[model samples]
Target chain A: MAEFVQLLVSGLATGAIYALAAMGFTLLWQTSQTINFAQGEFVMLPAFIMLSAIKLFGLPLYAAFGVSLLVSALLLGFGFKRLLVDPMIRHGVLPLVIATIALGIFLKEGVKLVYGAEALPFPEALPQGIWRFASVSVTVNDIGVLLLVFAMVLALQGFLSRTTTGRAMQAVAQNPDTARILGIDVPRMITYTFLVNAALVSVAALLITPVYLAKFDNGESIGLIAFIAAIVGGFNQIRGALVGGLLIGVIDNLSGAYISAAYREAFPLLLLIAVILFRPQGLLGRAEERRV
Target chain B: MTRWLLPAAVLAVLIALPHGLKSYGIYLLSLWAVYAMAAMGLNLTLGYAGQVSLAQAAFLGIGAYVSALLTVNGVSFWLALPLAGLVCFAVGILLGFPALRVQHHYLAFVTLGFNALVFLVLRNEEWLTGGTYGVEGIPRPSLLGLPTQSPIGFYYLSLGFLVVLSFALYALLRSPWGRAFAALRENPTRAESLGVDIRAYTLLAFAIGSGVGGLAGAFYAPLVEFIDPTPFDLGTSLALLLMVVVGGSGYFAGPFLGAALVMLLPEWLRFSESLYLLLYALLVMVLMATCPSGLLGLWAQARERLSRRRPPPPVLETRT
Candidate 1:
């Protein structure tokens, strides 16, 4: 029983990070109808930024985190508007996809050039201790991550449901033309979505860096996993992202524990293929009428 | 007469060029031929059929490993090559079933996942794939009784394959089936309404593309004399796609030119080392921005303009 509890706690902690990443991905897809292949790089860049701030500038941990989030959000928003979304307005889908992929490659190699393609230890900030109960124990960082994720989720929900801008964003996602007619600036909304999503991803990166260890290439795996989570949950659906992240987290943890660690990454991909084959609409997604 | 003259001259140059170049140049030429073949396969899928596949490398890897294993176990190169194509064809058809049902982005995602999965399998299946170390010591292909170990011998062999494949592909593209693929690309719904079997054509395109990719991989394994997971990663697949796009996807010779330039340009720029990628990225952006029609398209446009300006040949009144 205790072992199961331990697994559940760890799974939820990792799932929270995935959930945060998925939120950013879902937000981008929701507004733009394009998947940012560079989404993972957003997570990776912030962690690197935060680490640099602490190690080089001798900044306080909280200040470093704030600076990282702000810079990441600004950069992502700028790139999306200038490079991807704007060009996509005139070109076809392929160009947009290719552009994002180019951006991803550029970001990846740029980071590698700066960081020397090596993983670095993130400065320890979380309180180091564990709470034990009935042969089961949970670390303080794990608890902190879980609490932080839940708080962000609640705050996001509140913002979306109650705030006027948030409602306008949701309205735009559903029907951009109608929203535009109703006085919502659809392009600006899309840019705002990118900013908010980047902010959320940066927060996830800041919190999870201590657990995963920061690396230039880590974004590829995290972005891939977040993509799988979005697919499993159904693209463009917030609730689906949450459930999908948790489910993938549990499956990943269990598979690593029971199966060989080498096969752990394969599980999510296999699951994605199966879901795509059998349930293209995803677990929680609504089926749309096929055009052809 | 002029068209035939140019083509014949080009072919002669290609055939004789290897004799003058160094061994390294010969190796690079062979590699370019193999990549050109693979890019042509991708063209059928992405260019003609309008489907984006991120699993080209996976198919290539499958072909390489399959042929490598077969030849290393003493199977004839001729036999192993065909077998590799057949395997990839079957896998392609299987992949095509789900692929045809989804939209473009979803299909791309599935292919991306598929590539990742293939890489994972290659890295983990030590018993079969030789694991991360990869399968090495693949035997060089022999034609009839002649050994193909010498660079000169391999160069001719590669050229022969390239000529035969290109002709076959050109004929295939000019066929009714190729027209159907083009029709599907332009408008799937309209094609279906016109009694075209969209599903069947898409499946055929996938199978043929994978078969071509497999064949290229088989040749590549012998040329390089090694098969590793590195060469067949997602990056390779993306690079192939980039070649097709940069070369002008719709043209028959577009992918070949694209592949040749993309592969050879890096070699020519090897002195720059680290700056090569940054320059390449800048070049890609410039090309995409200024010449969306690609290099082949640009040439075609220029030729049309120049010909338009020239006076029509004096009407020689055939009094006789």
Candidate 2:
């Protein structure tokens, strides 16, 4: 029972990170109907930025985190999106998707080329200490991750529901042609989606990297897993994404303990394939009527 | 005369090109041929059949492992190669089942997940696969009394296989099956209305495409004389897709050119490993932009320019 509780806590912590990463993808999908393969690279680059701010610029931890998120949101969310995505969007879906994949490779190698090939250790941001009670123990890192994720989710929910821009964004996602007919600036909404999504992805990276250590390769697998999480949870809904993340986290932890550890990574993929095959609409997603 | 001229011209180049190049160049040429075969498979799926497969590398790995395991166990390379293709064909059909059910883009996840799963199994199933150390000392098949250990011998052998595969693909594409695949790509709903079973044709495309990939992998195993999981990852899968796209996806002769450009361009830019990838990615973007219709489109553009400067000629309505 103690072990199970500990596993559950850790699992939720990791799932929170996945939920954050997946939000970037689902957010973009929600508005623009564009899926960025570069989301992983978004997380990867920001983690490096934060590390460099601490290592090279000698900024304090909180300041570095803030600086990294700002730079990533501006550079990737605004600049790269305008330069690559805006042009490719006109070309059609294949080119846009391929370009994003290319951007991922470019950013990965760009980090390796400029920052050197070393995987840098992230500076500690969360408090270090264990909280134990009656054979059940949770680390401060776990608590910090959970609280930060919850806060971000609530903030996003409030922003999406309460703000004019957020509602407009949802309107665009619901029906782009209709939204445009109603005089909404659909492209700007799409760009805003990218910005918020980038912020959330970076935040996810900032929280998760200290535990796993930041590496160029970290982005690929984590990005893929988060993508699956979004898929299983229903990429259309925020709550579904969270549930998907938590489910994946629990499954990952339980499978690692019970099933063969060597194939733990395979479990998420199997679940993903099964979900895609059996439930393309996802667990929480409602099926749309198809044209005859 | 035109048909004979083109074939004669290509044949002359193929025969003369290997003899003029060094051993390493010949080896690279062989690798290019292998990649061309695989890219053609991808073309049939993504280009013609309109399926998005991110697991091309998985099929390639399956072929490599099957052939490598069989050959290392004293089975003839000739027998193992076909067996590899057959195994991959079955696997492709199996993957196609899920593809039939899911949306095309969502189906990419199925392939991606399958890719990751296959990689794990390849790396972990240590008892049969030889694990991370990889299977080595794969026997190169010989014809008659000649051994393919020599670079020249292997190059010709690979080229022969490529030629056979190309002609076979050419024949297949010219058949009604090819028309069905094209119809599926152009309009799935319309094709379905015309009594074409979308499910079966998509399955056929995946099976044939992946079988070709497996064929290339079988050749790749012997060419490299080693098999490991590293080369058959998402990166290589993307590279294969790049080759097909760059070469000109719908063109029959496109994969050959694309494979050559994709595989050989890096060798020419061997100044820095990282620079090569950056350059290649940039080139793909440029090629994709300049010739949204591909390299053939670029050629057509050049022809248009040349024709414009000359006397007015008959014009064809250009299709987007």
Candidate 3:
């Protein structure tokens, strides 16, 4: 029972990051209607930037994280969408997706060229070690992850429901044409959406890099798994992404703990395939109507 | 006369390609053939069928491994090639069941998952694939009692097979079946209304596409003289897709042009590893932004412009 609880906690911790990434991915798709394959790369590159800043200037975590978020939001996310993504959107979804994939390789390779291939240890942010409750012990990082995610979710809900900018973004997401006619600057809103997405993922990277170590391909793995999480949660529903990400994270931990270690990688994918087979729309996703 | 002239000229160049080239040059040309053939296969599904499969590399890997194993055993390379394609085709069909259920992004994820699964299996399953070391000692094919041991002979052999299979693929794409595939792409509901079995045609597209990918893999194994899990990863799959896109997806010659550019450009760049990939990625974005239609599209645009600028030739009206 203790072991199970421990696994569950760790799973939830990992799932927290997955949820954050997935939510951002869902947001991008919701507003943009384009599947950005490099969404994961964004999650990855920002963390590296933060780490590089920390190393180069010896800044504190908060300062490094803040700077990284700004750079990613301004230069990578906003600038990238305005310059490249918006134009590609005119062509169709496929080209945009492929362009993102190329961007993914570019980002990953760019980091590789700079940092070399080895994984670097991120500076410790949270207090290390465990808190014991009977036979169950929980790490501070795990607790931090859960709290951070919850805070972000609550904040996102508030922003979406209560703020004018968030509401405008939501309106654009629902129908860009209608929103455009309503005199909302749709393109600007979309770029803002990307900005919000970059900020969310930057937070995720900050939380995750300490646990996993900063690596070039960190974004690729999480981005993909989180994508599965979003799909499982029902891609169209933002809330569903939260549920899907947690579920995947828990499943990942449980399988790694209880199942054959050698086959740990296959478990989430196999689970995803099974879930998709039964729930084609995902756990929280509404079924998309087949168009003629 | 003009249509035949282009093909004839292209063929003359291709046939003369291996001659006067060093062994490495021949190898690069052979790789071009592989990528071109594989990109053509991917185009059949993506361009014509409107399905986005991110698992082209997995099928290509499957083809390579199967052919590698078969040749390592006493089977002829000749026999192994089709057999490899057949295996990939069957796997592709099996994959179509899950694939056909989803739409858009979901479909992409499914193929991506398939790629991940295939890659993981290749890495972990040591007995059959020799794990990370990869399967080496893959034998070359002998055709018509000719010794294909030499680099030139092997290059020609691969080229000959590529030419034949590509023409066959072209014919297949031009057939009534191809028309059905096109109709599905244009309007699936309308195609279904016309009594086209959408599911069957989709599966058929997967089958044909994977078979071609497998054919490329078959050649890939012998040419590289080894096989590993790296080239079959998602990046390579994306590269294959990029090649088709960069070449112009829907056009027949697009994959060929795209493949040649992708495979040869890096070698021509003197193999500055980071520089080549960086340029390739930049090129993809620039191309996507400026000319989403790809190289073939660019050529068409140029030709259209030139013809427009030139004074119109006097038209002779033929009375039918």
DockQ pick, better of 1 and 3: 3
Q: Note the chain A TM-score of all models in turn.
A: 0.94, 0.95, 0.95
Tell me the tens digit of each residue's lDDT in model 1 across B222-274: 99998889899888988888888778876787887899888987787778887
What is the Cα-based lDDT of residue A219 in candidate 3?
73
lDDT, model 2: 0.81
Clashes of each: 0, 0, 1
> Residue-wise lDDT of candidate 1 within A119-167, one digit each (tens)?
8888665677899986999888778878888889889888887999999
Q: What is the TM-score of chain B in candidate 1?
A: 0.92
Candidate 2 deviant stretches above 4 angstroms: A289-292, B1-4, B301-320
Summing lDDT over every window of 10 consecutive residues in candidate 2 chain A, give the lowest-scoring window: A283-292
Model 3 lDDT on a 0 to 1 scale: 0.82
lDDT scores in order: 0.80, 0.81, 0.82
The order by descending DockQ is: 3, 2, 1
- Per lDDT, the best of the predicted structures is 3
- Tell how far residue A209 is off in model 2, in angstroms: 1.6
User: Candidate 1: which docking quality band?
Assistant: acceptable
Question: In candidate 1, how many Å is residue A155 off?
Answer: 2.4
